[model samples]
Target: MTTPTTPPTAGGGRSEYLHGLDVLRVVASAAIVYTHLASWISGKNRSWPIGDLVNAVTSPLHLRPDLAFIGVASFLLVSGLVVTRVSLRESPGEFLRRRAVRVLPPLWAALILAFAVVSTGLVREMAPESAATALHLLNNAWFGPYFVGGAVLLPVVWTLLVQLAFYAFTALTIPLLRRWPWLPSAVAAALISVTTSLVPQGAVGPVRTVVAFLPIVFIGQLISLAQAGRVRLGAAVALGAVHLLLFVRADLVSRGIFTPGGGYHNVLLMIVLLVLLFMSANGPVARSRWTRALARRTYSVYLVHMPIGFAVLELLVDAIGASWALLISVLVIAVATELFYRAVERPLERLLRRRRRRRADLERPVDTDEPTPGGNRDGLAGRGADAGRSARQGADIA
Candidate 1:
């Protein structure tokens, strides 16, 4: 599908976006789900002392601050890497369509369902904010805490706005940064730090946190772009070390321990995870049918988890002890996710694909000299009579 306009530096591999990045999406989404489950079970508290007792009595430092902080950063890093691949070649129209298809419907469903299922007065609060919050424009009005219930997000979806911005920012700046990648990364980090410092802590803190988060997300993109591709061994060692350091030293910083932000240390951690994901995606580990299937339905899983998890948490609190609730909730979520995927996501995806094919056929180029809408043939990624000629004449980056 090479065309006359694609950037040669893009690696020009059609499977690059499809198989590589999809695998990482599967991995990152699963990690985020477990993290959310853990929070719900513990009533949003992770007692390190008790955690230490368990580590001493049972396994290793599983729920430690250092570990949790890095895990979250890893998610952001994965976001930066995959988003770069996605944004790099997408036309604005295609980008909007893909993003809307991937994010919106499930988000709407989750907002409604989570509000319906969660007791503890969550539904009461969401009842008033549901319509406005679903719009996302008004989500800032209630941002009492970064991941707190005041935000109308099903759970961690608010961070996705930062993700969305990162995608847009990267796309707009690609021509500029493709030549000097470090410039964008540095400025982005500086901006995030400056914005974070300006926001006074308290009621305004959560709302302001979104502003602070942008640069970090961009930083992740820059790090991936800078490496020029995969950064597995070097990135893994660097990230693993930095993540540990940030986890241990988070208390000294103002952004709070095990949370998304602190300073340079946290930003580095996020970048490292992103680089790691990029490297991993470049490999074949996550290209299996199971993982692809899992990635296809990740949006639904994300939406349903909060509301469903809340209901399960209520049940577990009354039945199982709070300590065990997180462990159990994740297992329950996996089963529910499978059902939701088969019942909801797959059917809609197939329908969309069919409609898209029909559109492509309708827009098929005539055999005459007039150009197509985008100045290319329809239905193909870019295939036509000119592909071989375009490839040889240094016109391959279409």
Candidate 2:
């Protein structure tokens, strides 16, 4: 069997070597973890002027309010590029199995843990209706908007929900997307960008939220196409970048650096940077062996950070005092997150892959040695292929 060229952690020699983009992806994930840990590890003291002053600067630093977005948005771009690339190459059967086994399980772990904390009333202030939302794995609207900043448990899972929707659509549409090539992505980006100015504030659902991002995701697909000589890189890059900026700005929603609107434009730029990183990543990224290693563990840290971040922040409050602890807690969480990624998440992923591969091989059809009982032996291979093809088409339904 041909091994695909995806990032491989140190677990197996067979791992897909991570390009710079992959390493960057993990860094973003870790940052999200650190950002949340800042809140979690802090102890509450209402009246400390000195503490307040320190926290004012330190908390934002961990949060990176300046670049809060690049993490999750880049997460989407990576998913879009990688998933679409997989969608084109792999059979639907393999894609679904790998996605389910590789991604959904670990994600579900964080969601369940978060729900447990909420249900038990240990953390009283998370959104109320989020219980139902949590069951859907953060796809539901119950969690509300407060957690949009990646400060809550399973925060990153929100991106996965959008990804699932896109993947579901892409699975069936891949054949068609392959045919027309540019139609789905072009329409998605165009409609979102144009509609952004049209829609009033507080619009909800896909259009108000991630649906608008369809164009952004499609742009990644476009980037991939351009690289393959399917389109002109200069034209795609130029048009895509312009729309991306305008979307990020979102027509002066808040007119501040900290505002979150105008994701379209930010995402556009993020994707461009990702493309560039993927191209020139080797020299700078590969140079730092430790940094690349850190990238490998990023997802693991992301999964564990939500619960741990809060605990760390809460503890930091008493140990170091509110303001100072908050500063130190960020560092502590970053170190702990690295440990978690190395110890738990990465190992489990490798184990699952081994078991999955073993099962898949065992399940492969075994030819019979018996002579043909009739004039023509049954064409089981053809039947199996047809069955698989039908199932793939059916499961792809949105």
lDDT of each: 0.48, 0.50
Residue lDDT tens for model 1, 309-380? 655666675566665665566677777777776666666566655765577568765566454432344333
Q: Give the poorly placed runs of model 2, Cα more than 4 Å off.
A: 1-18, 37-66, 119-153, 177-180, 190-207, 238-271, 284-289, 322-348, 351-398
Q: Tell me the tens digit of each residue's lDDT in model 2 across 1-398.
A: 11223322121111122255556666667556544543343324235554345456746334333234556666666566555544554456666665655556556655666666555544433433344344344542333333343234445555655666677667657666656655556665666666666765565433445554554566566655554344466766765665465455453542222244333353346445765566335556553667656655556666665655555455566667655755665576567666755555566656754764576556554785342321112211112332232222222111
**In candidate 2, residue 338 scores what lDDT?**
66
Cα shift from native, residue 229, model 1 (Å): 6.4
The clash number for model 2 is 19
Q: Model 1, residue 69: what's the lDDT?
A: 36
In candidate 2, how many Å is residue 243 off? 5.4
